[model samples]
Target chain A: MLNSMLEFVPRIPIAEGTEWVTEWLKEKFSVLFDPIKEHLGNFMEFMSEDVLMLIPPIIFIIAVALIAFFISGKKLGLAAFSIVGLWLIYNQGYWDHLMNTVTLVIIASLLSVIIGVPFGILMAKSKIAEAIITPILDFMQTMPAFVYLIPAVAFFGIGMVPGVFASLIFATPPTVRFTNLGIRQVSKELVEASDAFGSTGAQKLFKVQLPMAKATIMAGINQTVMLSLSMVVIASMIGAPGLGREVLSSLQRSNVGTGFVAGVGIVILAIIIDRFTQNMNKKKA
Target chain B: MPVIEAKNLSKVFGKNPKHALKLLDKGLSKEAILKEAGNTVGVNRASFSVEAGEIFVIMGLSGSGKSTLVRLINRLIEPTEGSILIDGEDLARMDKKSLRRVRREKMSMVFQKFALFPLRTILENAEFGLEVQNAPKEERRKKAEKALEMVGLAGYIHQKPGQLSGGMQQRVGLARALANDPEVLLMDEAFSALDPLIRKEMQDELIDLQSSMRKTIIFITHDLDEALRLGDRIALMKDGSIVQIGTPEEILVNPANDYVERFVEDVDRSKVLTAQHIMKRPETVNIEKHGPRVALERMREEGLSSMYVVDSKRNLKGYITADDASAARKNEIGNLEEILKNDIPRVDKETSMHEIFNIIHDSPIPVAVIEDGKLLGIIVRGSVIAALAGDAEVNIENA
Candidate 1:
């Protein structure tokens, strides 16, 4: 009797409904989506090809190593690691792919911070906003990275722009969550002191909250950059170019040696980026 | 007019504050209202006015709402009901722009935890208030420098707050408020976070600053001794309500209720009770009008061992013991000044009992209370002990 009752319930058409909604959004918002795709795609390509590719590999590697040296307080470890790592990637003939991945990750992380901070501030300032945004963030974070590619392709067609869109959906939550947590974790007495001195909302935010929350926000941004880097291999499924494409093609041909080299290149990039950003945070302190 | 006036000011925390306020007006107790309405009363129908250039202290134990009461004055915590007035201007009714202007121009606050921005240098922390007001950069920098110098932190201007000790950090906090040059200051347990020695040093500095600056101040503390030491007048709070508002002496001598009485019970009375509160009228002989024979006779009649000698205008000359006066009379010394002993201790009327204890311990005769060379009263050992024992009424007749 219970089985019959369970079978009597009709299945919900969530998949069909989502498809219809996506198609409707594509048809209706093409004007808005088209310009963003064209402009952003051109900017990303210009950054990776025109700007980054213009630098000689040796010069770029030395510059990054020097920056690592200074930012890590004259430490030899990070600078040595950067030089060795970049040299290995260059020797492996994945330097251009490395640059493409760098451009994709940097743009995605910047965009996440720009959009996430204000939303985080809103969540911190208002209970209603926090309540409304929290569940949406959870949904975005838990949803599989592959699930976003469909919408990303629908919105931006393909390439680095769609890659960024998918990565942004995957990576933006940490920044928003951390910014909110950082602002909320500021001592109550400090907030009261700010208010007591007649600080306007903007004044309190910029002067007191943001400066105090810096390390935490930087940590969040570091996580975001890592998340964006992780999205590259997945993003290549939609024709986004980079080491991710190298890895994808190697996977298809079952070329374990090439795929392993490409994977090592990504690991080297992640460590370099992570160490540089972490060292920057420590330098400020 | 008062510099800051709060009338029927109240703060209720939680949802349905309107209902809580209605319950407050119906005379329901704080606990009852909390139980029935799920609202906590922060400050309950508080009404007080702080005079210009005086330190008006609000004192209570933790959670008694003294902090809340002070916050209401500056509208840091918006009142659930009632109004606040600054120089006869209704602050509660002011728009946001005007309120911000008033906050910038009229008052600033200091906090207990030394809320200096750790990332900013000491000079930049001091510049915060003026920076918020959008003052010119050069002007704000100059004022911040001057304010930092005022707090004796000129040497540490370029150092961040994290590099300084607790007391020095608090000095930066103080400089931050002073840079604005506001007319009034609200200090919420501003020295509570410091160790006892540093707290005392800060208190003395605040008193010194008050003497020169004479800015109206609203100070909050959970310490009874601090309240007595710094307050020109103190309001004692209990359970979100002010139970008494009076001078420290009044609060100590005649507490408004059992709660206030218990609150002040452990205060060191010697620090608060002064010579004026414990002094007795001294029987004196006028040297120009009376001889040693008359002085000896007057001493005998009053049953005193010694008598203070004064001139026709009542300036303290010295004192004559009964033996000295009698011996002088036998030796034909007509002037009382000829035999008078000049070794008696003298203290001002405002001298604390703590100081009198040190002086009176070495003196054979009573310590004479003098003002401008004229004797007002004398503090005897018995009187000092009596005052410390809470019998301040013993010398009220002389006052």
Candidate 2:
């Protein structure tokens, strides 16, 4: 599996078009473009609303802080010192731009959960849903990060919308994969106990089964956040601003120091997000 | 009349018909269910009714239908065929709403793994069923507290299942079931996962609880000792079918088949039997010799039951009660006390149960063993037979 994955990893970036090999394979499987376009359209409309763009990210930042506090208490304040340190080193003010990335990432993640969880449940319930979905998940996951930008740019043009859009597709598969896995892995005995004790289908899903699968689902969320953060730098090459744009501009002008600094900023952001989400999962568990 | 009845209950998996025309079909046969499952025959055509308040046990080995059978009683898994009637209402025929209502209102089940909802505190786990049924929050909370109290987990209500010991987790499961206050409690080998000592403690606790609550219980187990300890009538199962359904005494004495007889023969009857089995028969002699006068008087006083007679050594030889001794003289009376022989149950303290059983079976009277008999114990024929059976507890009445 590892050998195949590594060998396939380089194959994904080979848009060095196959002039000889099978045109039939390309045309037969080319239904993804239109749906991807419609999704990009819906995403742009959703993000255009001020409340949709503004309030949720702010709430998410607060929720992240609250989660941090609950786990390590006033220790979270000490971590904020590094945040200030990054701002000083970047030289340019990053508060608004960082907030935009946070906002867009949060919105994408929320949508992933909303869409992914139901898809997961449907997939879990039916073999046909699983059969259709599992291959799509493989394609989404194995397809190159850079390849996502090509279509995202073609469809949504360039903005925070496309950045969030690419991140959603990349990040969503984890949540959906893990949700189905988690729900399916729950002990049959527990499900029977719930049913035997007279839990309605809706009640069983929400109360008994969902809660039991929570730890695994939370793990999926952690994976999603990490995957979304990974897309942030790549998405910056298109036009989504934040640390990514700084890295791009720094590299373009050959300001190696500034680019390195921006790279450090993204790495630090990933670590912080990763740690906080993991800690939040621990607290919930 | 029986409170619960299963009419030819059967279950089959796969969409394939028994005799399939299409090659795509998975064959429907025991071998097919086995090869596909490789190790399960959840339930078969099992039919039995538990009288209200009866401790009905369905006993089987793993992969036997005990779990699936009880689940069928409550319709947890919809039976592939047949119907389940609870108090004259068909559970299998009920609509979803009525089925759920029956579950919430009539029956609650406990699981082998505890399944106590680790995400919730003990109180919340107990209250989950009530909450699902849409009970008032305060009422449910109060009821959960009461249940916790009943299970002796009162102080631990706020603790999660992860924090509790296995025994305590099972208590929480029990508390959760009891909180709903249903008429029937289905125990799916509830104590099977616990340590032996904990299992014993839980079994004793269940007996104590059932004594007070009198819930019509359908308990499943593979252990004959457990079946004997807990059940009023045990249904011995092999594969998916019930081999025998009887009190422990009946099952022990007269197992319907060799499989059941073999199952009972290996069980330790000592754990099940008590002094009640070999008690001295009822006494009919007066305080003195020549005590009774007429045949009618002897019949009225003795009721034909035997009385025990002992020598100076306290050794029992044989017994002749007023009924037999009175036959010696219809017109005249005899020394009723002296005339009666001591035929109380006799055996060495170390007498093997098989020997004792054989002796009792052949004799019309209970055998009396003598060796400085200080009246240590007597084995009643009924109880000996009971002890060898599946779920009969001995009841001893001391003189």
Candidate 3:
């Protein structure tokens, strides 16, 4: 009886629908999307391949260590840890791969924040926008990150750009969600008070709303960075090269030791970025 | 003309305000109107005027719409019906731009929560109103500094609002409004959040500020004591409608209805009622109009040990006792000034009964109520004691 009941449930055509949508978008909007793809590709290459590689390895290590130290309020311990961590990745011969992953995460996270914050503010201001965007955010967050790669590759075609495109979708929801939540959480009294003082709409937004929502927006940025890093290994499957590629190849060849070392390198990089951003948020507050 | 006036004002907080108005016109209660129309009446057909430099208080309990009324004066919440006129300019008819100008230049508001910007320093918060007006940076800083000094917050100019105590933060709120140099101020329960002692201190500070600044103010409060202390004339509200409008003594002595009577039932009449409310017409012998013989006869008829002496113009000169009057009459003295005693205790009509007690206790005669050297009335110790004891006969007669 259970088998017959199960058989009665029709399979929905979700994958076919997704394929058609991607194809239709690519066919109709290629002119618009191609430039964006080209620019992002160039920018990613410049950051990961050109500038990072051109700089002497010792100088690069010192710069990263300095950034970590300054942003974390001169925490010598964290700076030393970052220096040691980066040195180990270099010693283990994964320095270039680490740089590639760092560039991808930076680009993806920056794009996410730039796009997500305004949408989040829109959702905060307008009920219709909130109603429409909320379910989209939920789908983006809950849907398997791996599922996004199919359409990313379908449109952009196998490369670092597609990897970034895939990771962008996986990472944007936090900034959008948190920016909306932060603005919404602002006390009604403060908003009314601002209005009562005859603050223009723009003044109120820049002076009151944005400043009050800083910590939360920073929190969103932090989450976006973390989520972007998490997508590195998945993105490598679409030909994006990074520590993720190292891990993927190790998996394919069943080499546990190489994968573990690469994974540790990613974790160290994440901790360094995370602590810097969190400290920036605290300083702002 | 009144600086601010609201005529037939009403505010209903829902979609079906038309239905709410209909129900209200039929003389239904706020609850009934709300029930029938799915609209909550925030303020109902409220009509009052605040004169220039006067503190007009709108007082009620939490749900009685006192806050809503104050907001309506500034058009913070647009009224559902009627019109508001500030200096005879219809606020209800002004465009948004003009309204913004009015808020910037003509009127300012202080909130109950001490709505200082959390991120801005005390000086910056004070500069907010001036900045909104596009005041130049130098001018804004100067004006904000002056205002902060006025509010006794000059020492903490660079400190954020969160660093201050609740009382100090509220002072910053006041400084923000004052910096604008607005003609009228709208305070919506501005001190209701403070501790009791701080609230009293703020009230006294506001009174002192009002005397010096003389700015027209519309103040809202839920506490009867605060209303009595701060308001020059108060309009008591209940269920979104004003039940009575009177001076504090009038409200105490002659409550408009049962509700108002009960509202005042718990009030200490000695604290609120003034000598003017209990004073009676003084039995006087005019020095220019009567001789010492006449003064003696008048004192005898009134059964008084002494009587006030006023000039022909009713200017209070002094008092003369019956013994002095009799001595003057026997000695054939014509000038009554010789027998007049200038030490008779005199008080202003505005002096509260609490202060009158001390003056009346040591006085040999009734305390004469004088304003600007003109005798208005005399406050006898018995009548004051009677008023304070809440004697119905005394209150009724005074009313």
- Pairs in clash, predicted candidate 3: none
DockQ for every model, please. 0.80, 0.64, 0.68
Q: What lDDT tens digits, residue by residue, belong to model 1 across residues B1-399?
A: 898889999999999899999998899999999999999999999999999999999998899998888888888888888899999998888888888898898999999888778888899889988988899999999999999888899998999888999999999989999999999999999999999889878888999989999999999999776776789999999989999999766676567898887776555576567788878788999989999889988999999999999998899999999998889989998898678788879999888776777788778888999999999988887665546544347555544
Model 1: number of backbone collisions? 0
lDDT tens readout by residue for model 3, B1-399: 888888999999999797889888888888787677789999999998889999988888889999888888878899899999988998888988888888888999999998888999999999999898889999999999999999899899999999999999999999999998999988999999999889988998999999999999889988777887788898999988999998765676677998887776555576577777888888999889898999888888889999999998899999999998899999999979899899978888778776777688777899998898899999886676556534414433353
lDDT (CA) per prediction:
0.89, 0.74, 0.87
Which stretches of candidate 2 lie above 4 Å from their native place? A1-70, A73-85, A89-96, B14-40, B269-307, B317-334, B338-351, B355-367, B371-377, B381-399
CAPRI class of candidate 3:
medium
Best by lDDT: 1
Query: Could you give the CAPRI-style class of model 2?
Result: medium
Q: How accurate is candidate 2 locally (lDDT)?
A: 0.74
- Residue-level lDDT for B187 in candidate 3: 92
**Candidate number of the best TM-score:** 1
* lDDT at position B322, candidate 2: 56
Which sections of candidate 3 miss by over 4 Å?
A: A1-14, B269-399
lDDT of 3 at B250: 69
Model 2 lDDT at residue B245:
95
Tens-digit lDDT track for model 2 on B1-399?
A: 788889978655455423221211343545556565443345667899889898999998876778888888998777876799998999999999999999998999999998877788999999988998999999999999999999999999888899999999999999999999998899999999999888878998999999999899999998887887888999998877788999866676577998887777666565434344444443333333334454336556655555454444444434555566556566455655545554355676556556676567666665554446544445557656545533244443331
